[model samples]
Target: MALAPEPGPDWSAALSHLVLGAVSLHAAVRSAPASRGAAAGFLLQALAATCTLAPGLGTREDCPSGAWVATVIGLPLLAFDFHWVNGDRSSANLMLGAGMALAVAGEHLGPEGCSVAGQAVLLVVAVTIAIVAVFTANTYGVWGGALLGAAGLLSRLDEDGLPLRRGDACRWALAAGSWAYCRALRTQRLQWE
Candidate 1:
């Protein structure tokens, strides 16, 4: 007999990520001079969204390997997310990258390594990075770090046998919408600048 799928919350949040990612992609395409960095961010967001949306082969219960990998890849890319809108702060991007990498590393450490402690550290670092982005007025990056950071911690719920829930959808939605917003806003500003 075939195995049954796990029961969980309806895919409202998961579906939201899919739509937001499409809109983000569209916005990125519209912004002609947007940095290659922004393109990378949009693509990563789409990948993560797709992974969560799938019910495909090798897809894990209430989540998939693809989703997990895509989400990880997005960590560093997020540092690049608001580049177009904020006109690029090379240093801020660098710090954001390093911070996210640290946070992700912390997750793998487990209880002995203080996995939860590491996650908390990440949340703090993420906020700090976003604040720096805000200080320089990197609107999208600010949004990117803030939302993605929350998303990062929330994905933890999917670890072990925890069922996928609103948290899963929320993080992806936060990421996709933030990217799309930054892209659209930047494109509009570029026309006037």
Candidate 2:
């Protein structure tokens, strides 16, 4: 017997996960010192995720909107990480902002039949941004960036003629990444203070 088709996105499940992530991150940021920039970064990431999970919006147009939300949230989070690493706020913010801009451009051009290489290049750029973010930002930023990066790669895999299995794998990877980050952050806080 053939395997059954996978169900379409379950908006309710997505929304539930988004809410839990947002709330947990919000609390974590609140506990951190204001100088750490964790609060701002967490808030932005939560907003981006929530926007992406919004109901009744699943189309190419919705994707760009989601990408814009991700860009807005990701840029500053990346900058905070850079500042944490190099103590150069201005330069770090500028670089991250540029990356976000590129990500937005990729989202816009992707559905329009960009070449496979083009899509791959865009994903590489996004992953580079995430790598920088992981080192500079806190655990939350690290995990969120990783999830986003994985999602980007999985999306490219689908674009490049991979099976739907790749997309399913991407979804699971994203969920795992987010949950792991949240758990790690909580544990770190418990241990540190």
The local distance difference test score of each candidate is 0.53, 0.51
Q: Model 1, 1-193: lDDT tens per residue?
A: 9889888955667567677667556645654355555455456556655665556623544343334333444434544444434555674466456545754674575544544543454465357547646676656646656665765566465555544564555555465545634553464355436
Q: Which residue runs does candidate 2 get wrong by more than 4 Å?
A: 1-38, 52-63, 72-76, 88-91, 99-148, 159-172, 175-193
- The TM-scores of all predictions, comma-separated, are 0.55, 0.48
Error of 2 at 53 (Å): 5.5
Considering every candidate listed, which one attains the maximal TM-score?
Answer: 1
Q: 3, model 1: CA deviation in Å?
A: 10
- Per-residue alpha-carbon lDDT of candidate 2 for residues 46-83, written as tens digits (9 for 90 to 100): 55455546556566466445535444444345344434
> Which predicted model would earn the best lDDT?
1
Q: Native-vs-model 2 lDDT?
A: 0.51
